[model samples]
Target chain A: MKLLLLSNSAAPGRSYLDHAREVIAEHLDGVTELLFVPYALADHDGYTAKVAAFMDTLGIRVRGAHTAREPRELVASAQAVFIGGGNSFRLLKSLQRHGLVDAVARRIRADGVPYMGSSAGTNMACPTLRTTNDMPIVQPVSFDTLGLVPFQINPHYLDPVPGSAHMGETREERLRQLLEENDVPVLGLREGTWLRRSHDALELGGLAAGARLFTSGAEPVEHAPGADLSPLLAAEARFDCRPD
Target chain B: MKLLLLSNSAAPGRSYLDHAREVIAEHLDGVTELLFVPYALADHDGYTAKVAAFMDTLGIRVRGAHTAREPRELVASAQAVFIGGGNSFRLLKSLQRHGLVDAVARRIRADGVPYMGSSAGTNMACPTLRTTNDMPIVQPVSFDTLGLVPFQINPHYLDPVPGSAHMGETREERLRQLLEENDVPVLGLREGTWLRRSHDALELGGLAAGARLFTSGAEPVEHAPGADLSPLLAAEARFDCRPD
Candidate 1:
């Protein structure tokens, strides 16, 4: 299976999908058409139009999964499947409502169709959507998502603002709590960075600096852009706490 | 009913519960014993001990609901109830797990027991926990919480950091999406601020500057500290979209 899980579609001072252009082109190489899941987007048509315009630069045609009479069939037949980012909960809820979660997962994990997501889209590729930063404005039937990867993806991660008075949990603290309840490793993907998986090999890449990985028993480890993170994919679940 | 829903227990450079001393004293006046719900806290014992110490200064005895053999009975017999904040989702899930959601809500809404919550705790007093900023690390049986208030509370409300590159939705945008789906209004309680309810009157107070109120279709309006926001309580649900 191949995947391009992007932290964000756009970076500050960059045009839409500009930062991810090179990666997207390489990831979707030889794919003439792609199926776009726009459920994560609030403005579905606008998101589809913008994505289609971006994909045009790569000479690929884009179709909306929302408009398809049979979304599962669309995922099954697509050359590459892309999930655009917005609200993760809403996106997952819509996918569950449309009965496309397993279908999309099957295409990406078992059938070997290329899968790509940014922000909320990337979150969908994780074992569960528990690590998403989006508000729980809507509840999905479950937090489960595509288990394309063994771990969780926290897209658009940010370091806490120095000296800010906000008392909410930092990105690190939240992930620590997640480790308390679950054994899954969490990868904090900073904006402008992404993870690429080609078969068994996984690597972090982008114009940004690096990503932070949090496992239960160890300190959060940072890896620079283009660093190999394939070991994380194969590592057995390790817990600081005793397993249930 | 008396309620002290704080955005945060303390301000930067202040001691825990320090910023809230006077208001908390006033809110809990005439109360001898207070029941503390510390489930939102990752360290329940640490939280309870600190809270008990803080209440000792106010000449009040604090009991931990987590250690109680009968949490519902504790809620029923308490002169006041306080839910400390850590994770709103965890707090709600614990209350639901212990069958204390309705008991606590009934105490505040009907039995006239004084209720106080900070951060996640403040979020619980709202119509729903949908507006919380906490990560959904765990799924509650439902997003429903103690509906002691007509509107929702977005504790630790912050404006977008100027010139920051984070592409995720701002607090305002998240609330906008919430309004899209739910008709309830949202009160953005910035850190160090809170809304006090004494019977039918609701007033915004604390050291922080002001609170932002979001209703469907209308621009968010700011309310200064000590603003008599009782009208918000009596106002019938207004929606930019058709009401459900």
Candidate 2:
């Protein structure tokens, strides 16, 4: 029942995992090795190597699910778990293809393995991948995800740019349309921000802007950094339905 | 196969359907009554009323698919068809829900009923709705669309904004990822531009900019305004496969 959902791996001009170093360290406390899910990015080997190198700096050993004979068994016995960002649809498809969706979720919930993900990885922890901003390049068997967290996570969220000529739907409008069809709450995790879930308590963290919360029948509200976000977790209990 | 696929309904400070009035008039030549699919927008009646009022000026009568007792029958017999802009996933779901997908495609390809769509509507004309920029707020039974056109259409295409802080996938990157898993061509239609298809001929039109074509094993190529896009249609023939 522990999670560290990051909006992105790093802020602008920062190295990989630079902004999230301390948070990752704290989440992986006393852990020397972890299972890394690199299915989001297409180049499994390159992605695995890049992430493994980064984790090495944190003094943690990294093993990729791609190299495992039984990815589920690796997740079950891992000291910690992390999923990197790329295409959410691709990641979900791989998870379903490898039959690891339930395994990853069980490891995080029942086994209490510390789960960490960024971008598409963060989206994997949600009730459904419906709130993802990634293009539907591939269709997963279902939009369902791990449900490690009760609410949805929109990673790398951004407000509309001012005076811009682009006419595509803004991030907020997209989430609003999702709310019309789905009753679950959505956390708009701006870059450098993340949600920390521990048992019954959830909190927002990081610098820069606060997280934007989109709940049904309400205007989106902002939660300051380091603020307790357990209310959204509780609100998830009130709504018993998940998007089909 | 007659089609008018627009990148957007209107540009900044322009009336609804204003920029494409002449093209729409030319495409709908000799047609008095046309079928309007307004399921993309949430307010069906409001969307129908607004579009009806606008068509009144062009001396054309509009019938909404929403009010029809048999939506598929209406699509089959319509003199022409038009779908407005909104969430692509929602529109695709409604099309599948009311069983209008095949009917609309048959009307356009077999019956030669002129098909006109903006934004989500344009995406529907493609083989698959994968290239759509709209959020996947709703998961359609499938991403398959009408297949009226051989390639995918990315409406409202824009390059990365200069000095912008947004880290979401760029239009080109999203399309590139699509090409990774798909071999079909993708046309990035900038705002104010559209594709005009008549039988076997295809062309680009409008004021803003050229259309960017993303094909397999090639960097994106720009087609100047008013250029004949018939080559792409022929290439579609050589491939002999449609996106699933």
Candidate 3:
């Protein structure tokens, strides 16, 4: 299995996908066409057009899954898959509703199709959508995702603001509460950082801002770019949840 | 119906419930015993104990509903009910799992039991938990909440930071996306603000931070403390979701 899971698509001042242009190009080398899943956001055509325009500059053609008559078939025959970010619940529901969750997962595991995701797309690679920071704008069939990765991923993870007066739970506190329920590790990927998985090996790469690794009963540990995170792939995931 | 929906339980540097002590006292003027729902957080006993200790100062006796053999029956007999803050999904799931959603709603509408909620508790008063800022750490039987209010509430609503580089959805953007799917107006309550409902009357109360009101296809309008918001009680809510 090969995957490029980005924490987010854009950075502060850079254009969309500009911050990770080199990494994305290297990851999609030799791929002529990329299937784009744009169900996370409400505007499918607009989102696909934006991505298609960006990929055109790289000599790659982008086709939206929503535009296909049989999205499942598109996923099955795709050379490469790229899922963009927006709302995780909306994206998961669309994938499940269209019966493409298993198809996408099969392509990645069985056919070794290169899978790339950003933000909500990165969350889809996790065992469950339970670690997402997005609002529950919509309810999916379940919190379960593709399970492309064994552990959970909290994308665009933010640190607690210093001396802020907001009474809401910090990103870290929310992740801690998740640990209290499920026996799985969570990788809190800050913006500009990403995880690349190739079969048995996983590497953290991107800008200077690294990522935090959160495990049950242990304090979060930070890992910088170029750090090896393959050990986490071996951790077991036991979700303590019941579906109605 | 009488309700005290608080955005949060505490503010920075302030003790629990201190910010809303006077309002709480006024809301529960004639009540001697208050039933506490602590299902949002993992430590039910600890959460109940903390609220029990705080309510004791106001000459009110507090009972943990989790300790009762039949929590539904406790809601039926209670003079008032207070649900504290934590994960909204966890709170909604626990209430649904234990069959307390209808019980609490019945008490508020039929028995006129003064109802109070902080954070996740306040979110429970809405038609659904779609507007909650918390992560979807757990999937409830449904997004269907108590529906005590006709609309949704986004608690701890924060305005966009001027120059932050975080690529995650802003509080405003998330709520806007929600409007795209559902025909409902949402009340964005800031840290120190709350909504008080008494039969046909509704008012915004608390500090000067004020609150923002978001309606579909329209710009979010701001409302100051002491602003009359009863008109919103008449707005219709149509949730566009399918339960799996």
Candidate 4:
């Protein structure tokens, strides 16, 4: 069982969601039961209904993952577990508040659930949620999440804005700083792109995309999707999840 | 005295130190006794040499502001402060390790020193350094920074790689998160762009290039050099920097 991560909720007239849907249909054709998390949708106008309707169109019924006693049972028994996107912080907060963080982590690691995450959904798989560029809608206190994936996922990456005075750091520059401070690989994924990691190697999964693997001594290499990522993923897994 | 911030070092073939020349010549036409900070220089391959060369390139001689026994004296005696760009994390860490955080903050606010920052230099002006996308080569344990600017800055606006699968939040999505979390304004500057904040107000500055500002309940607006940012800057100053 794998969790499919969607960066945003699938709804009417949004092209980005459609790309996510296509990836699900192609990779998870036979899977049926899925737990949908539209945590970012709590306040959006009509967003909840829109997500429900969108799942209906995809032939996958969406429900709150924590609605049941053992959501992992549903996840483990299902053909696939899909985590829809919204706000990374909100969804993570909801998970932490519900005490489902550990449950979700156990499911993804032990239950063989195929986890596909997009955007916010994708963000939860990392070791810490701090890597997200999303506004800190909710501070989780602890950045611990599913940890199915070790590296930070930078989705829909766009370069820094030009010729203006607003200064913090460029997205790439920030990620570069993260890379230098910690030995982790931050995959900068654009829309309609994803990485599939099997064991010690990672492979670019979706549309043509470039990813950067940051490590010590070696210059970060920008590679396109469909390239092997297993080596990177496997190598990074050696580091324990214990907080520094 | 004012602080001048630069986004990155400088365009290729144009040494960042040379940028200092232009700034001193144009911005500080009548000023003397300047201070320079190369925080991001920690990650550069040859930052020390670069800094030395940049200092040498100046027709007039200046002293390193870092030499002061206290951050206050360093900032107080200077006609203006200049921060050179490199890696934000390294620069911030150096400041923190040297215990210059509050010193820099006091100099900027209490002392009323005119300050300018560019590239990584500009990144340090925000109250919290979390907005920077630079990889954390060094962690200062606190995001609190010089509060010279309220909003986060995205410098060196570049585009996503053409045709890539690493899809997720595009650069705009990242800024959206910043805006959602920050009721304050966010400025995205291209190379050679800048914003000036004085008297609790922010105004677009220099660079014929473009800049973008993101705020709540409104669309992003473009800013040209010398545009008024008082309203934006004032509201941001009111925002709570403390996380919930």
Quote the TM-score that chain A achieves in each candidate: 0.95, 0.95, 0.97, 0.80
Cα lDDT tens digits, model 3, B140-172, are 888998888899999998999987766667899
Best by TM-score: 3
Candidate 4: global Cα-lDDT? Answer: 0.60
Docking category of candidate 1: medium
Model 2, C-alpha of A240: deviation from truth (Å): 13
How well does each candidate superpose onto the true structure, as a TM-score?
0.95, 0.95, 0.97, 0.70
Please tell me which predicted candidate would have the highest DockQ against the true structure. 3
The prediction achieving the highest lDDT against the true structure is 3
Q: What would the per-residue lDDT of candidate 1 be over residues B6-116, giving only the tens digit for each residue?
A: 999867888889998999999999999999999986788899999999999999999999877778988988999999988887788889989999999998888899999
Error of 2 at B218 (Å): 1.2
Error of 4 at B1 (Å): 6.2
Model 2 CA lDDT for position A222 = 88
Instruction: Please rank every candidate by lDDT, starting with the best.
Output: 3, 1, 2, 4
Global lDDT of each candidate: 0.86, 0.85, 0.91, 0.60
Instruction: Give the per-residue lDDT of model 3 (tens digit) for A45-147.
Output: 9999999988998999999999887899899789999999998888998999899899999999999999999999999999999999888887777888999
Q: Candidate 2's residue-wise lDDT over B57-120, tens digit each?
A: 8999999999987798788678999999998898999899899998888888887889999999
Off by over 4 Å in 2: A237-244, B236-244
Flag clash pairs in model 3: none
Better of 2 and 4 by TM-score: 2
